[model samples]
Target chain A: MFKAIITVKLRPSILDPEGKAIEHALQSLDYTALSCVRIGKRIELQVDLDDRAAAEAAVDEACRKLLANTVMEDYTFELQKA
Target chain B: MSKVKFGVVVFPGSNCDHDAYHAVKHVLGSQAEFLWHKEGDIGGADVIILPGGFSYGDYLRCGAISRFSPIMKEVVSHAQRGGHVIGICNGFQILSESGLLPGALLRNQSLNFVCRHVHLRVENATTAFTNQYASGQVIEIPVAHGEGNFYTDLDTLAEIEDNGLVAFRYAERDGTITDEANPNGSLNNIAGIINREGNVLGMMPHPERVVEQLLGSDDGIGVFASLINAISGDVTIPGVAVLP
Candidate 1:
């Protein structure tokens, strides 16, 4: 078995509306030191695969098929043997 | 009468519901109704649209809070049964958040709310939504949003292309959708995509804004026309005709 941890995030250039709203809220609260903020998702998966290569392939398939949308989100994974 | 009924979902912060409703009723001359977010049902419409806007004040992420609305549950069930669903801008974000569509809408690469007229290359004409457009045809549409950046892994990107799920791509004046013309730095210059069933489409551009000549261009008429035609059995997938 193997465990896969996936980190998904938006590209760097796109506007982060949630982040901006939070920044605005922080400013309203008199918190002026913070400059920027971005939000992302993290997912973990456990698959009964034998090899690292197979586990990686499964993670990739899951991300493409449903976990991550290629158009708006980027995802990377780290695999470890169980 | 085409007998196709369209419904536009109106969430608390949805700003483009009226525009989309008019696009369907006036431009397509069909029966279109407004659906509130709190409603339990979608009124059994043929096509359900999630209009653009800052739904739920874009809190907890663009569409995060809106995803849990009473209406979204029905929308998800409807979509699973192969109902036609289209999400534009913030609607697209809601779709992602509700898991009706894969992937997430992130901050734009430029870190600004981009509002401009952009050229898009039709990548897949086989879907119900893109049947009116010719594969590879370039059309101009207006986009206004902040978190429109599209992201996915390289393998998934390739899969989307291979499966013909990519509906439209951002392009330049030369009709080439390349990295340079990519406004939000989306992977593969993708501007729109369809779900695996090919029944749901999510795009950032506002087709409703370009449907009338008074809006500076009627390029978006074909898109709306295509959807109407799809229901009326006037058009078919994989047809051989170039779109302007």
Candidate 2:
């Protein structure tokens, strides 16, 4: 079995409104040194595959097809044997 | 002339499906039906309306998981066949996710769910969906959503403008495009856009919700009338008359 860890984030060019709100909140709390803050999601999945390469391929496909919207977001994944 | 058949796709979380159906069946006096999301066929609809609301509970992202619904395959094929398709609000997000539309909707710059009436200037009235409205006309439509800020690559944005694909732009009551008139900070104040082929439109406004004067404004009736006229070639725009 393999476990795949995926991270999805809005592209740098796209504006992150929620992140901006968080940044404002942090500033209010006196954490004023931080210049920027962007938010994203981390998804973990378990794949019952024999080979690491096969598991990686499956995870990549899942990300491309569903987990990530390539139009405004980017995704990266790492697979480890379980 | 035959009545234009409208199929309102009912995704699991779609709240506007009934509104769309009512607008077509009652307000517009046309044939309308509900198409469940799991069905693989379009049921011979001349126009397919992907109504608003969070589909699949907006999992992953707005309209991402719902794009994989079985009905979406048929919707894509229908769009490829040059049939008419309109995605309103969340439906717009689904169309972008399914690659039917050019851009994606992002969270509003204010990070708040905005719900109110806004003016939209008709940018391209020559298309199948805007023929009933005069060019440069400002119409009032209600928009309700958080993820309505439209975004695209700069190259695609240039192409969309060069091709005149923008159908409507957020504007002042007098039809001036300005940042203050923009409800969601969409690029170029875009409120609606048509596909290159001019048959598919994805917009953030709920035209179906305002088709009757009783609801607030009948400005949205033009959109349905335009579609009906495009399909059946004979629809008279409803108007106020001094009761004989």
Could you say which candidate leads in lDDT?
Answer: 2
For residues B1-244, could you state the per-residue lDDT of candidate 1 as single tens digits? 4467899999999999998988788766778999988999999798999999999888747887788789989999989998899999999888877777767666787778999999999888878888778888888999999888776656777788889888989999768767878888777888899988988999999988987777777777666667877778653222223253
What interface RMSD, in Å and to 1 decimal, does model 1 have? 6.4
Query: Could you list the chain B TM-scores for each candidate?
Result: 0.94, 0.96
Candidate 1: stretches off by over 4 Å? A1-82, B234-244
What would the per-residue lDDT of candidate 1 be over residues A1-80, giving only the tens digit for each residue?
A: 98888987765655566677888898989899976877778888798989888788888997875666555567888987
For candidate 1, the C-alpha RMSD (Å) to the true structure equals 9.6
Q: DockQ for each of the predicted structures, in order?
A: 0.18, 0.85
Q: What C-alpha lDDT values do all the predictions have? A: 0.82, 0.90
| Residue B76 miss distance in model 1 (angstroms) | 0.8
Worst ten in a row by lDDT for model 2 chain B: B235-244
Largest TM-score belongs to which candidate?
2
lDDT of 2 by residue, B68-87 (tens): 89999999999999999999
lDDT of 2 at B20: 90
Worst 10 residues of 1 chain B by lDDT: B235-244
